[model samples]
Target: MNPTIRSLVVPVTDLAATKAVYSALFGEPHTDESYYVGYNVNGFEIGLNPAGNGGGPVAYADVDDLDAARDALLAAGATERDAPNKVAPGVRVCVLADADGNPIGLRGK
Candidate 1:
């Protein structure tokens, strides 16, 4: 696996307000995908996903092999949810629940 984060998606209650805050903090928007707004900081990508649909603040860990990453995290005390499945057509993810029930996601290209 590459073991590098491709992007981090943050679920916000107020889309416009959050976008404005991130825009100010990052200086400008790199890309906006309607469902998502991306900002580049150095080389890392941050995405803002609108609230609803069981969405929440998501922490992403990018991996060359999403399945492998999911397996490893599962071995290390993280509970897998929905296995490594596609969130969108090309974007794949493994949903995990931490010891405290906090959500963490491993993403793959």
Candidate 2:
């Protein structure tokens, strides 16, 4: 599958404050939930996650096959942080950590 970095997730300490900041910056959120807030900017997604890494932001690449992409990462020395899980009706996401323990996310539909 061709990988495209379509999303960038930022870890937030305060969801409401973070959402407001991003809303002002991005002109409003397309997705607003207790756990996540998503904004669409020129077809790219910027997400705020309450349960994100404190270290830094996580970048997500869009893939045609979530499992295949995840497995390839694992084979290349990445460790599974979260298995493939359905977040929406047709959307599936998986999180993995590189050798240095940095988080990377994969999203598929």
Candidate 3:
């Protein structure tokens, strides 16, 4: 699939409090764990990561080829915030920073 921003991850200091707020807005989460909590708001994902990004939410663009896409972004001056890692079976994710230090996440199969 072409890259599209469909997933958003927010780093939180207080998981319980933040989870409550998101739950109220988006209903119950589809995936819940101590490391990560994810809600499926329609097709898009609203995630709460207690130990993810330090700043704001990171929007993830779903891509077909993770390595190729990441390399292209690096060539265009996007710095690597995090290397590609598998979060689930057949699913890999990585974070990159644009020129302004804004995070950009990529997820692929």
Q: In order, what is each prediction's RMSD in angstroms? A: 2.9, 1.4, 1.1
lDDT of each: 0.76, 0.89, 0.93
Candidate 3 lDDT at 10 equals 96
**Model 1 ranges with Cα > 4 A deviation:** 51-56, 81-90
| CA shift of 53, model 2, Å | 4.3
Best by lDDT: 3
Query: Over the full model, what C-alpha lDDT does candidate 3 score relative to the true structure?
Result: 0.93
For residues 2-99, write the lDDT of model 3, one tens digit per residue: 78999899999999999999999988899889999999988999999998869699999999999999999999999999999999999999999999
Top TM-score: which candidate number? Answer: 3
- 6-103, model 1: which lDDT tens digit per residue? 67778777778989999988977877766778888888888887742344667788777787778778899998654666767777876788898788
Name the weakest run of 10 consecutive residues (lDDT summed) in model 3: 1-10
TM-score per candidate, chains pooled? 0.74, 0.90, 0.95
Q: Cα deviation of 61 in candidate 3 (Å)?
A: 0.3
Model 3: per-residue Cα lDDT at residue 66: 95
Which runs in model 2 stand beyond 4 Å of their true positions? Answer: none
Candidates sorted on TM-score, descending = 3, 2, 1
Instruction: At residue 70, give the lDDT of candidate 1.
Output: 80
Worst lDDT 10-window in candidate 1: 50-59
